[model samples]
Target: MKIARIETFLVPPRWLFVRVETDAGVVGWGEATCEGRSETVRTAVDQLAELLIGQDPLRIEDHWQVMTKGSFYRGGPILGSAVAGLDQALWDIAGRHFGAPVHQLLGGPVRERIRVYGWVGGDEPDEVAEAIAAQVEAGLTAVKMNASGRMSANGSAAELDGVVRRVAAAREVLGPERDVAVDFHGRFTLATARRAASLLADLHPFFLEEPVVPENSHLIGRIAESTAIPIATGERLYSRQEFLPVLQAGIAVAQPDLSHAGGITEVRKIAALAETFDVQLAPHCPLGPIALAACLQVGFATPNHLIQEQSIGIHYNRGADVLDYVVDTRPLAFVDGSIERLTGPGLGIEVDEAAVRDADRRGHAWRGPIWRHDDGSFAEW
Candidate 1:
């Protein structure tokens, strides 16, 4: 069927959803957003629509290639994220047309369920013990939290100790059976990251995410050599090419966001590339249901899949949570902290188009929160 029109919805709590309509009346849904820059990605999708309208909806690969390679200046967050959402919508259409789930088209699922992790400890991280306990009570076996707030280039010993203390509390609450992932959030310097890694080793974290920023990925191998803890990064990375070097750096886990890494088309390749280096795949998904469903489809099919991140109660979401816009939140039903197989066609979860349309009319202009240090200097949030 030929694509007839492309529509975008800027929904609540920082999400942009895209809808692709075809000549045969079959429509597909996609989540194409970059958190704060939902409007920018929406514009990018609008520009990319010129390449998709009147094209065959089933030709996902061709559309992806043209949408990506068609532009000489391609592959950053805006372009990749825009292509990502469109690709997801096209894949959804293809799967629905064939009466199969996306996983079946991708060689069927390799597992019945994939373990998922929840977010605990907001940006600054206080009362982590209580947060961990609450998530455990909610049936989550693992929880990820930010490692620290803003720190100087030369962080003090007290700052380092505070980081350890919070982690210690989380470990104490989680005990030994469950996992706790500490995200540095790219807020630490090389020396500070190394020091924190060394200090937190005793707490036995599941992984240290983005110890430094993506630019300092070269230091990951050195950091890995310093500590036994697995180093995980790549939520900021958008393609397999960007991920190849990090995998080569001996990173233990590759956390590519299915929404940001060119959707399923490119992330599947990223997963394969990670597997070659014996690196684990833990997709970074802190978005809505469409993005989460896309990640689960890949997670269920990938052999090296480790854990998936869901944004059910994540701090970024305000009025609208992950399940608010879904027609059947049951497909996302988690049991013992793991989501079972999605048996529906396309991305498996049917979105509430009416809710989406209503929310779109109320359109969001959401942006990430800005943080400042004690001296009023800007800090990553």
Candidate 2:
């Protein structure tokens, strides 16, 4: 079947969804969410659609190469994210056409179920406690939180203590059996990340995410070597070539966003690359259902997969939640701290077309917060 129409929708609370329809009466859905930059990625998707309008829908890899490398200026967040959504839609169409799940197409099931974690707010000690408890109540065995709100370039003693204290509170609630991940969010300098890593090493967090920003990736190997905490990053990274340096940096885990890192096709290859480094894969997904579903599909097939991140009840979902646009929520149901294998075809979840259309009519222009330090210099958020 040939690709007939490609449509993009700007939904509520910082998400962009793309739909690909084939002439043979089959439709596929994918999430091209760039969080703060959905509008730009929407335009990128439209531009990329020009190459895919009449091509065969099942030629996923060929189309991905062209969409990604067709232009000289390629492989940034805009183009990678645009290609990612279309790639997901193409995979979904292939799965549906072949009457199999995407993971089965990759290879047969390697595991029976996938473990998942939720994002918890970590600004305050009480917030961390309550958030972890709520996730525990929701049957999530693991949860991730920010290391600090907007940190100074050189973290003060108070800043360092507060980070440790908030994590300590989460550790108290989660106990020993559960896991908690600390995200630096690229707010810390190399010295600051190194110091935080030394202080928090005893708590044994699931991982320290983006201890230093992507631009300073040359320093990550030093951070990884100094502390035993698993270093995870790559939400901002978009391709396997970009991930190579980080992988060689002796990181313990690689957290590539399926939406931002070239979707399934590229992330699957990334998983393989990380596998060679003996690192685990925990995809960075804090968007909507389609993105989470795509992550789960990869998790089920990937052997070195560590855990999954989902955005159900995450603080960002103000007006709409993860399950709002899905026809069946059973596939995404969290049980016993893990999601069972999705047996349905394609991405294993049905998109609610009507809900999506309605939400698009009242489109949102959501943006991530911009932070400035007390000195008025820009700070990472």
**Per-candidate TM vs. native?**
0.98, 0.99
Please report, as a residue range, the 10-residue window in candidate 1 with the lowest summed lDDT.
121-130
Q: Model 2: which residue pairs collide? A: none
Name the weakest run of 10 consecutive residues (lDDT summed) in model 2.
121-130
| Tens digit per residue, CA lDDT, model 1, 85-113 | 99999989988999999999999999999
Tens-digit lDDT track of model 2 for 1-381: 799999999999789999999999889999999988999999999999999999999989999889888988877888889989999999999999999999999997899999999999886556899889999999999999998888998999999999999899999999999999999999999999999999998899999999988989888999999998889998988889989999998998999999999999999999999999999999999999999989989999999999999999999998899999999999999889999999999999999999999999999999888999999999998
lDDT for model 1, please: 0.90
- The candidate scoring highest on lDDT is 2
Q: What overall lDDT goes with each candidate model?
A: 0.90, 0.93
What candidate 1 gets wrong by more than 4 Å, as runs, is none
